[model samples]
Target: MTRPLRLHYAPDNASLCVRLALEELGLAYDSVLVDRRAKAQKSSAYLAMNPNGLIPVLEIPQGPMFETGAILLWLSDTYGGLMPAPDDPARAHAVQWLFWLANTLHPTARMLFYPDQYCDGDAEGLRRTTRQRLSHQLGLLEQASHADWIDADGASAQGCYLGPLLRWFALYGGATDWFALQRWPRLLAFAERAELQSAARKAASAEGLGPKPFSAPIHCHPPEGSAV
Candidate 1:
């Protein structure tokens, strides 16, 4: 008998990426909602599965896996799709982009979204710095990707990871006015395409994030007299 696949997730969190990947791969997995509002992720039961108390722990037959990038990579390797072939020369490049997203983009976004978690002093200053850094990083990414997706060929796990981050950044990072889609046309186009994917749509709906997650810019300006 096949072992069942399960995912522990929180709505609008990084877990959304994993959900999208599962849906795209046509894998039927059960989803367990983690109550972030109640601090359920920090509970003993959830910490046993992921010591970091993060969202998105995938329970496979072998064991439970944490870390968004690791989960996505494992899923791609095991399922043998949505990624380049193992021996393909482009595989390394693809893997590098995934790591870049995990290490650079994701953490930067966390700082912007939860600045208080990082430091107690100058929260607004921290957000301003993080937003500037993120803008620079996004500029580099825009220059690197001249096509629809990061990988020249087509969409991959990298694109899957990027879609949600971009949407969240635009919506919540307080950079909407300055970091408009018009400035990053290529990245905007890529996000638009990713949003249109069937699996992406399903995953967004499952998370209660709505269908057009990456729709037109919302232009959320920072509060008055804020450092952002």
Candidate 2:
């Protein structure tokens, strides 16, 4: 029997990261979709699990894990094939990319995507700036995507975990025209494979998380070398 994991996530939020990981790992999981719009995450039930009331809390075989990065890491540690061995240098590379997504790229993209949180007035200007900044990161991601798994020529294994995040980036940054990523058929193919394997799709045909309107203030600033 497959041991099921419990994942608490908003239908639209940071929870997508963990959900994507679970899907990529091919693990059976029961997802509790917390409606952040209704403040369901702040309810007494969820609060008992995560005092911070964050989305993407994972209840693994070991215990509850809050925060998107932690949940992903836990899955990597607990499940084989999702991550490289702990002693492998590639494992460090995976962790580095994970943190880069969490601490830098994700936060930057959030700010650009949701300028309503930063300023009350006309957000169009902020959006343009954010888009420009996002483009630079996407460009970096495109170069990074040239690695083993993404590059059709290479036989190396890599995290296909960046798929959803890149999809979101393309959606927001208007970056579907990126030549580098487009040239990498392997990466696109990998994303499609992972998306098809997602639990949300199998269970209810849900598309996992979609882009939500954000109003949370960005706690982090745009990284240097960002076009914005």
Candidate 3:
């Protein structure tokens, strides 16, 4: 850990999740903008780092890492404190929710935001179905029997992940009219609380997200790159 980690990011993209975790962990790192406005993620340099050509790629001592969830989990496990310790009673529940967000909620968001990538026809229909599914998924989170994984100070990597997903749900997916965080009181409450975390505050300032980025999102006016 002699050198700081390097994070390749777009201003308000999924990299924000990794950014939030790094801030919370108090790790100093450098950021390289991917310049989505220029399709920089698809460039040869970036593709070499990640064949999938996604927005975030964390350059660590081991090598360049892709996938937001894997980066978050690695930071948590490598540095600790971002989740319940591996042997703790709460650890299993903590990891489960992290995977659910990554595996379930996140892919659904991708389908909604970039429908063309998921299909060649009926893109609108895909979004229509996805919106309904997103609602039901949020409802499951709202009604989950336990949220100790995320409840304390937006402390886990999952909270960092959820906060951005919440923002994107209202801001992306074509017609956001069907979505409202207020409909799920607990999640809305989580957004309200998550915004107050020091890490979230730093992210807002760095990415031109307003003070209420999570609880009440507006389209980002990033200092450097485009969100889309």
Candidate 4:
């Protein structure tokens, strides 16, 4: 029998991209909320699943998987959809964007969102510097936005990863004003179009997130029990 898939997640975390990917693939899975306020993610049991103590730990039939990019890649490679063919020339480009999102953009956004975690002194300074770096990165993305999606293809995990980050920039990084969408018209258009995607909408709705997902008020204490 095919064992049920299980996802250990916390609200408003990076795990969201994994959920969006699963929804896009039309895959059924269970969601186990890891209470951040309660430190459930740091518990021994959770750590056993993901020693990194991350919010997203996908338990597949064979074993558990950690890291947002790795899980997304596994799902795409295993499920045979939402990614370019392994041998396709565009596959390299797609993979490059995915890595860039995971490594460069996501980490920089984290510095902006949780400055204190990254630095002990001058948190605001760290945020300002990170925000500036993020702006440069966004400008690069805007310049590269000649395509409808980050990938040459229609929609992939890359778009799923980027849309939320853009929203986060508006909510946490003061980008809504200083780095307004008007400054990056192409990225704004891409985000708007990505938000309308069925999978994106469904995933956000499932997480109790609103249309302006990152703008939504995060619940420190979510409802008790599994959200599946």
Best by TM-score: 3
Candidate 2 ranges beyond 4 A from true positions: 1-4, 120-122, 145-149, 152-161, 170-193, 196-204, 208-228
Candidate 4 ranges beyond 4 A from true positions: 145-148, 151-153, 173-176, 214-228
Across residues 149-178, which tens digit of lDDT does each residue of candidate 1 receive?
453434578877888888788778544565
Per-candidate Cα lDDT values, in order, are 0.78, 0.57, 0.91, 0.75
Which is better, 2 or 4, measured by TM-score?
4
- The estimated TM-scores of all candidates read 0.89, 0.69, 0.97, 0.88
Q: For residues 54-110, could you state the per-residue lDDT of candidate 3 as single tens digits?
A: 979999989899999999999999999788888888888888999899999999999
Q: Distance from true position, residue 127, model 2, in Å?
A: 1.8
For 129-184, candidate 4 gives per-residue lDDT tens digits of 88789889988988873333553335587877887777667766543455576688
Task: Order the candidate numbers by TM-score, best to worst.
Answer: 3, 1, 4, 2
Residue 65 C-alpha lDDT in model 4: 92
What lDDT is reached at residue 126 by model 2? 73
Clashing pairs in 1: none
lDDT of 4 at 171: 60
* TM-score of decoy 1: 0.89
Query: Higher-TM-score candidate among 1 and 2?
Result: 1
Model 1 error, position 128 (Å): 0.5
Instruction: Pick out the ten consecutive residues of candidate 2 with the lowest summed lDDT.
Output: 213-222
